[model samples]
Target: MSAQSPIVDLPCALIGFNDLVALLHALFIKHGTSPEVAAILAHNCASAERDGAHSHGIFRIPGYLSTLASGWVNGHAVPRVTDVASGFLRVDACNGFAQPALEAARALLVDKARSAGIALLAIHNSHHFAALWPDVEPFAEEGLVALSVVNSMTCVVPHGADRPLFGTNPIAFAAPRADGPPIVFDLATSAIAHGDVQIAARNGERLPPGMGVDSLGQPTQDPRAVLEGGALLPFGGHKGSALSMMVELLAAALTGGNFSFEFNWADHPGARTPWTGQLLIVIDPSKTAGQSFAERSQELVRQMHAAGLRRLPGDRRHRTRAKSLEAGIEIDAKALQQLRELAGE
Candidate 1:
């Protein structure tokens, strides 16, 4: 896996999203999942990759299957809304994956916003949700301003602290444009995403200085050390740590999930499950701007583009997705082989 070694090529398979979902469903079934639930989970993973989030795509199958086998996730549980008032709603996931629960909540928010002009939702007891951009992109396309936040397992250390204290909480904002893709900004509060660290480890690369620390609370470039007992650093010293703390309070405390110093670690199977939390907000543009909102948005984007910004928020992902679609997903041979073995291919 070192850089000095030749890159290994995986067998390329050209298939539609549906085909990928079918293959994933079959694999989940083999791992003892109910066919109906497997189909939904598989579709979610496939959709993630289609939207250019390879880290949360098919690679997550093995981990999910393990969670199922260990009973950390209740495959049969249906999410329930426990509170609703005015323009706010709260849901309890009941130990299920976050996607279905969040989707249901987002649907409610969108539907309610059409009438009330705004809606907010909070969810708890959920597992890892995929990329936040995909969740907000649809709302933006529908002429709504969308915002979302999610708290993960603790892997980020606060400023001037040696021990890990907060998860790499992610936040996303999206606003519609008249003539181009929606303006979207989705980022982790940490210096880098945990997925990028995992990818770097798989490729046998060293993390840049200040990205993470080792088990002994010393700076290290070895990805394994970071993955095993170390933690990622915040993005901008205190600013990032402050943002991470804010998300911890908003997502975990406000939503009744675990929070700083108490969050569960995903790497520990015997540990209490990391029942994560999420918050979403949606605002209808038509309520404020009448019919000229789209034109104003277009003009704003044109001005920004004219000022020399070469790429829009989601433009790079769109390009990567197009290339992946044309050439097939180019996973490493070792990773591909592991997936195939898991699928019993």
Candidate 2:
């Protein structure tokens, strides 16, 4: 979710964060989502764009509208949370989007983690099409460590397989630090995210070598070829393949959700989202570290900087977010016009 390549040379305009959120909120509610669900998704999407995660930002609005129109998702479904155990919580998203479900259970999840030293929240029957970092970064901001995983639509080929089976399946982690912002990162198991591939295709850009293969299973740099009946490869061959397999097991099987290859959307032509599951684990690092976890993390950062490491995992994003807040987010003019139309402005 964190990988972003600026689309240079586009006609751009600037919009404030709140303004973007309000516009997206109106658009989602106009489409199908309830006010509550719309608010959560709108904030999630706007945050991505604000942080320069272009692939998962406003670029996804059309797919969302199409899925809503196709009846592939329930935009108004209320999430049902279950108190499964002292340190575990489960949320049934009721076939709706994942953000609302996470919002619904956020309070209880935090309470459990504080009380039990660690907590796990499993969400199933959900559609998660946004970036993964947003789901865990807040916990880090609250002086906690969090890890999350979510499976996507099947578009990645396993290391030794001839066909695609695994989803892009991203993993995100965040940990609090004493010095500054939390240490955070989000990356797909595949060499590149499906959304990035789509962005490249839309912009008529060529991908780097070894990103994906065509329908004939031949390596190709053309994003269109990869999007059209082709598939992406694992980031580190067998290692990424194994991690993706682990993601499927944890996010899907353990959460009682559909596997990446299980859901069929043949009847729902415009359904671009994956009906899958998500898992998040939150830890009270102070309870287990026996010392100041934030201080320790800050020390690690200091050492990395002393070693000539120019930037950390979330440095660029934090810098971008700061600049965006100071001087509105930059967005493509055409995309903003389309969003206005979608919001019926």
Q: Which parts of model 2 are misplaced by more than 4 Å?
A: 1-8
Q: Per-residue CA lDDT of candidate 1, range 283-327, in tens? A: 888888456677788898899899998887788877766776776
Q: Candidate 1 — which residues are off by over 4 angstroms? A: 1-8, 32-37, 263-273, 324-345
Cα lDDT tens digits, model 2, 235-256, are: 9989999999999999999999
What is the lDDT of every predicted structure here? 0.76, 0.93
Q: Show pairs that collide, candidate 2.
A: none
Model 1 TM-score, 2 decimals: 0.88
Point out the worst 10-residue segment of candidate 2 by lDDT.
1-10
By TM-score, who's the top model here?
Answer: 2
